[model samples]
Target: MAETVGDYVLQRLREWGVQQVFAYPGDGINGIVTAFGRAGDDPHFIQARHEEMSAFQAVGYAKFSGRVGVCMATSGPGAIHLLNGLYDAKLDHVPVVAIVGQTERSAMGGAYQQEVDLQALFKDVAGDYLVEVNVPEQLPNAIDRAFRTAMSRRAPTAVIIPSDVQEEAYTPPAHAFKQVPSSPPGLTRPAAVPSAPDLRRAAEVINAGSRVAILVGQGARAAAAEVQQVAEATGAGVAKALLGKDVLSDDLPYVTGVIGLLGTRPSYELMRDCDTLLIVGSNFPYSQFLPEFGKARAVQIDLDGSMIGMRYPTEVNLVGDAAATLRALLPLLTGTPAKAWREKIEAGVAGWWRTMEQQSMVNADPVNPMRVVWELSERIPHDAIVTADSGSAANWYARLLRVRGEIRGSLSGTLASMGPAVPYAIGAKFAHPDRPAVAITGDGAMQMNGMAELLTIARYAHRWADPRCVVCVLHNNDLNQVTWELRAMGGAPKFEESQQLPDVSYADIARAMGLDAITVRSPDELGPAWDRALGAGRPTVIDVYCDPEVPPIPPHVTLEQASSRLRAVLKGDPGGLHLVVQGAKTKLREVLPGQDR
Candidate 1:
């Protein structure tokens, strides 16, 4: 049989090393779907319950494997549903390729059913590349460029294939599709390294400062050892952006936890007190968490030149690959370590961890969410891959989960959207079949997507020999994060209509999907529940009933936030009063004899 446009597209995708393509079947995409079926399992096709989940699973695959993820959807609504997850990939700087099926060329733009302007719909989210197969011959080049651009730019790209174009015969003599391919595909260019002059300038800035702090993000994933080397040589305290949490271990003496509201007190102190801030691979947008511009000199190193001065003004900007840049910059620096600075940072880290341990141990009626996260942190295997959804669940995850050695995970960083954890866990499990994959999500986020995703997990549970996928649902029966945000942001009253969530049995939902499920109503059952899920040898869900009143208190709260808490308490919110009391309790610690007081 002669090759079709759909066959060429799938062939190119296989050449690009796309092992798994998240896809949903539809009439408009039947040709491509059939082509995928003919290709066998080299590039396995994963069927998602929703188009959104398909795209999100792609994002998760990219994040865990450090490779470009691919997703396919049908025309109109299916394509539109991909926008959110694609935007998550874009904002998080992960590579993803989206192949969307479009209406037949003849039916487009004539008030026909399911006819959407693909280019216009994807303009903002898929900024790196977006093109339609208007001409049958254009499919080959479009597919090539879309994957290439996505990998190079670390952003999402889109290719729209019209139904007619997909079915066109590929008898190519005048087109490049049948021509001799140059160098076979899938070869990628190496990332640029820092120049000598940039290294010298960066070294000079670091050498002049007595107190240096190193902040890293996902860009530094490959440079963890080099980052430690630079920190040791320069006597710098290391602070991780949320995306870089796993780059360094929490127990490391010089390593401070993440920065921002989901960050640690010691990390805030390091940022505030450092004389020179060296930012590598992170475009953390919370400038307020950084030291004032004039107060501290800054040096930024990133693969993207445009992102160099984006987060903070830099005295030195080194545009290059993170590991290479760090390696080059190390030799130019003075080897003198600042002993006093290191001691101070170590002391601060110790104090902060003590406080964290205390907070994580607090027993509250209805199980405390922090205790659940803390217990899981202690029990997870060394090679586990963990994920967390947005909302109050993130608070416990950010604060309690410690990433060390081979243990790694991710959260929705810039996009901060909910409903990705369940799918992300499935993706992560697929990416590393032998590693334990866990998803931590809230009641609201679980209900939003977890129910459908439970089926996705059950479908693929038998594919991998090791069945260690777990979903920990924090069942608080409220939009707990937003409820706290309303009070913390000074909103007058908590609107019950928008803030409360219906009580539902996530365990039952998981069980109905043929997953091993357990529900824990008390803290005593937490450890055993986690152990059971970890050893279930199948996809499992642990529905934990958590306290709804625990506030995700920020390390630093503004006066306006304080006012908001007061107002919320005055307006008769019991949860607000709990927050206020917690604040007072924290303050009272300063007056205790064995503490800082």
Candidate 2:
């Protein structure tokens, strides 16, 4: 039997070492679906409930596996649904390759059903590389380039194939005029390091300072050991960008936790007090949270030259792989250890953890959201892969959850989009079937997409060696994050019509899907509930009723923000009194006796 272009597509993906392709089926992709059947699932087809979830699952797989993620969809609506997740990958700088089926070539310009101009649609999201394989001969080069560009640029790339082309007999590029040939699929990335002169200059900036602070991001994950060595050599406090939360363990005494709006007081103080700054593999966008310009001499090292020195005014910018560059610069650092500065930072970090504990114990309507994550922190498996959705839940995950040991954690850092927590966990399961994966999500996100993805978990749970996939839903019955954003950022009262969420029993729904389920309405139930879920032989959904009025306060609040909340209360905000009480109690933890603040 002659190989069809669709069969060749899967063959090429296999050659590129893709073990699974996250996808959904449709009539437009019938040819490829048929090829999957003929190929006997050599590269497994992981069907997602929707095209968007498929893309997110790929992102999750790529992020955790440190490989290129591939996702597929049919034309038009299926293609359009993939945009958000692809954007999430692009913004978060994850490598993903998207394959989509297009309408038949004859129907493309005729406006046939499901025929949309895919080239223009994908141009921006997959701007690094976008190609339409109009002929069987174009398949090899097109698919190869998509994977290569995705990896080289760390961005989403796309390859579009018309239905007719996918069904045509496959043909390799001829050794003739007008033919373009591609080499076999393989990528060998070089370890790039800055020049010796540049490394010395950066080291000089570090060695001259009496107090140093290092900021690490997702880019620094590979350079964890180098980052620690540099921190020790310079007596620096290390602050992690939210995306790099797992880059270094929170157990390190000099680690100041996450740095940004959703950060700790110690991290804030680390930036405020540092005389010099070393930014590694992080392009953390919030400059306001950093030291005041000119107060600290800064040096930045990143793999991408374009992103270097954009977030701060740096004295030196070294474009290289973080680990390689940091290793080269470490020996040149000759500063005397700032013992006093190190002790101050460590003390602040200690005090901040105490504050977090105190804050978690504060009273609320049913349960404080912080306590939910705090409980998880106490019991999270050392090797767990944790993911958090964007919402008020992210606030708790950022502050309360302490990532330690081999625990890997991530979320939509740049996109900050909702509804990827469960799908990410699903991807994590596929990435490492032997490890336990946990997801922390808000009620709003669960209702958006997490509920449907639970069935995906139930479907694949048996394949995992360790089937402890836990989805912890913060059931607050409100769009809590945006509701608080309206009050704190816009001085607007919470309009119940838009902020309120329909109450649903997520645990009951999970139970219906044949997974273990638990419900917690009291703080006392959190620890035990987590234990049961983490020990479960299959996937589990934990629905905890959290307080909607508990504000996600930042490490430092401006006077204007305080006034805005006051105005919101004066303007008859819903839950105004409860908001004030919870906010006060939560914030009081920072200023209490023994706290650094």
Candidate 3:
């Protein structure tokens, strides 16, 4: 049988060394589905419960594997469903290629069923690159460009294949004038370094300051050792952005945890007290958390020149790969390590961890959500890949969990979208089938999509070499994050119609789907539940009933936030009394004797 366009597409993907493609079936891609069957599932097709979940899984796979992720969908609704996750990949700077099927070319202009103007629809999300393959001759170059652009720009790109065109006989581009041919599949990455002058200037600024602070993001993942070397040389306190949570181990005494509203107190102080700031590979958006505008002489190192010097006023901007640039700068740095400053930062980090423990122990009606993550932190394997969905769950994951060893963690950092945790874990499993993957999610997100993805896990659980995929659901029957945001940010009381979630037994549902399930109502049960789930031979779900009234208090609360909370309580917030009690208890841990400034 002669090769078809769909067959050639898969062949190109194989040439690019793609191991899997996350997708869902639809009639719009009938040709491709048939081709997949004919190809014997080479570059395996990993079916997701939804197109959005497929895109997110691809993003997660790309994030963990350091390779371009690919997701496929059918026309119209399926393509539309992919936008949110594609946007998540775009915003978080993850490379993902979306292959979407379109209506038959003949029926496109006549508004055939499932026909949509996919180019206009995907223009923004896949702004880096978007193309429609109208003929078989466009195959190799179009698909190759999609993958190449997505990887080079670290953004989502798209390729639209018309249904009829997918069935056409494959044809290579001719050696004639108008045909475009692509080079063989493989990208060679260069280690970019800044100019000698910029490195010297950055080194000079670091050498001149008595108190130095360094901030890192996901971009710093490859440069962890170099970051530590710089910290030792300059006696700088290192703080991570949420996306860079796993870049450095929390066990490092001088490593202040995440820096932002959900960041550690030591991180806040590290930014506030520093005389000089060094931002490496992090585009952390919260400028208010950094040192006052003119107080600190700042230097930034990033691979993208467009992003440099935008967040803060920097004395020197070095556009280069983080590890290579830092390696170059190391020899130029002549700073004397400030023992006193390093000691103070270490002391603050120690106190902050103590405060986190105290906060986790605070009483709640059922379980303090913080305690759930704290317990997991105690038992999570060294090589586990942990994912957290957005909401109050992120607060606990950010503050309570400590990442060490080869552990990798990420979320919708820039987009802050919910429902990616479970899918991300699914993608992580594909990325590393030998390692255990865990997802921390809230009830709202679990109901939104996490629950459906459990079936996907159950379906694929048998394929994993180490089948310990655990989804820990914070079963608080409330949209807890937005509920707190309404009170703290808008001074509005919790509107139950929108804030309250209908309770569902996630564990029961998981068991029904042929996976291990554990339910925890008491704080003491959390540790044992986690152990069982982690040791389980298959996928597991731990549904812990959490306190909806527990507030995710920020490290540094402003008077305005306090006033808003007070106004919310006075304005008849439903959980007013319980909210006050929990908030006060959670915050009290910070001022305790052992948690000294």
Candidate 4:
């Protein structure tokens, strides 16, 4: 039975549960595209503009959906274009499987059109590359291996499906590889405990502590309930790094707060006041900001023994998982809790938490970006997936958002990047078009990549599905934040870049591209504009002209950079005179502020 190699590739992906492949069709890959269109059974190919955007969009889908995100490109240049996104996904630890069309197998050494060593080109970017000449029989094995490697290592895998092989076939033998769902861990722990006396010694130390604090990390997320139980037994206050936010309910009274650079200073101060700081599950990077050994005794716990003392110096190091360690230590704990020490620590935490929260509030009426995003967050539908592009907008999102229910944070689980949010929103829409997906992009970041992807929504709506996507642009007229940053860095004023951006208009550009565009310059117009845009329900762009400086540098950042940047903006080249006008304009604006436009 002769079958097209393209058909075999489709069946292999179907077996592996790949429902969508984000792509930009090219003549070199027409056979596969046609085969994909006919596969039916609810599988669909999403067409993207540049193959680069397609790759990035696929990476996002892979990361959030925990599925093998598939992308495809034609041979040579098309395949070359996917490298950036492939590398991005690789570095970000995402599972992406890229399928690049290749020159006919027989044309390899003849310098064929659009032919090159595609495998060598993508070697570094992909964790694994499979150049399969035959489909049907060989393709399934390669697809299985690609998914296994990608799922385990979270790196991209690229498959080279040469053109001529598309028409070849091999009937499947009676036996086929069956797919299975990943199951949760059950019953007993993997590692055993130490001597009973050692466990007793650890528990004794923990029980005698007058004030106890548990610092939660990713490991804690794995056994959050167990960690919570330990905290409940000791009545210790809990603090966590960014990754552990949703591990324990944020609204829990016993949960002190987040502890890190972007977190409240009170948490750090509270840790200093405590007699014991138990580092659980995470080796958070900022040890200097943590309470010093002189201020409090530090104890570290981890599933991997070596991770202890790798970051901060620890007085006690436990070589078991956070949950196991806590369970073992419970029995050894002795002595009644000290009333005075606990009360003083609790008082400090209470006072500090209150003051820190007060600092988060903003009342500026071309409302400060902090207040704006906060209010905007309140308005978003619960379960909405929000992606934030970098720069001032991202900074604000990190500070202002409150995850009350289920949500995907812009920079939560991975190293944050710019230009991802816009394209990511497109992928999110494709993943769950029924739900609201909003991309909050800064003017600078949007201009960096937004021009290339605005029509993805249109393509899906007019070309694939009816559009229900939202693209929100935080349209600050200039790179005001960058200008301020350069002044702080002792570099030449970046105003040269800022002054040049004033003429750019996203609303005009979105309208030009056939998207519903609305520019909201004032707080009063924001709500109504958003409502109208949401109601219109196509690919809509709401350009909110926000004040760039409204994102006040958090306390963690030193003002030294801000001060130096101000001087650089003033004296760097002939911008001295311009800074004077800008500074004065800034002051006048304070007295009688105009629209950010």
Q: List, residue by residue over 54-138, the lDDT tens digit for candidate 3.
A: 9999999999999999999999999999999999999999999999999999887997888899999999999899999998888
What would the per-residue lDDT of candidate 2 be over residues 256-313, giving only the tens digit for each residue?
9999889998999999999999999999999999999999999998999988889889
Candidate 2 regions exceeding 4 Å error are 593-597
TM-score of each: 0.96, 0.99, 0.99, 0.76
* Candidate 1 vs. true structure, TM-score: 0.96
Worst 10 residues of 4 by lDDT: 179-188
Report the C-alpha displacement of residue 439, candidate 2, in angstroms. Answer: 0.5
Q: Can you rank all candidates by lDDT, best first? A: 3, 2, 1, 4
Give me the overall lDDT of model 3: 0.93
Model 4 residue-pair collision total: 8
Root-mean-square deviation of Cα positions for candidate 1 versus the true structure, in angstroms: 2.3
As a whole number from 0 to 100, the lDDT of residue 64 in candidate 4 is 55
Candidate 1 or 3, higher lDDT? 3
Position 116, candidate 4: lDDT: 82
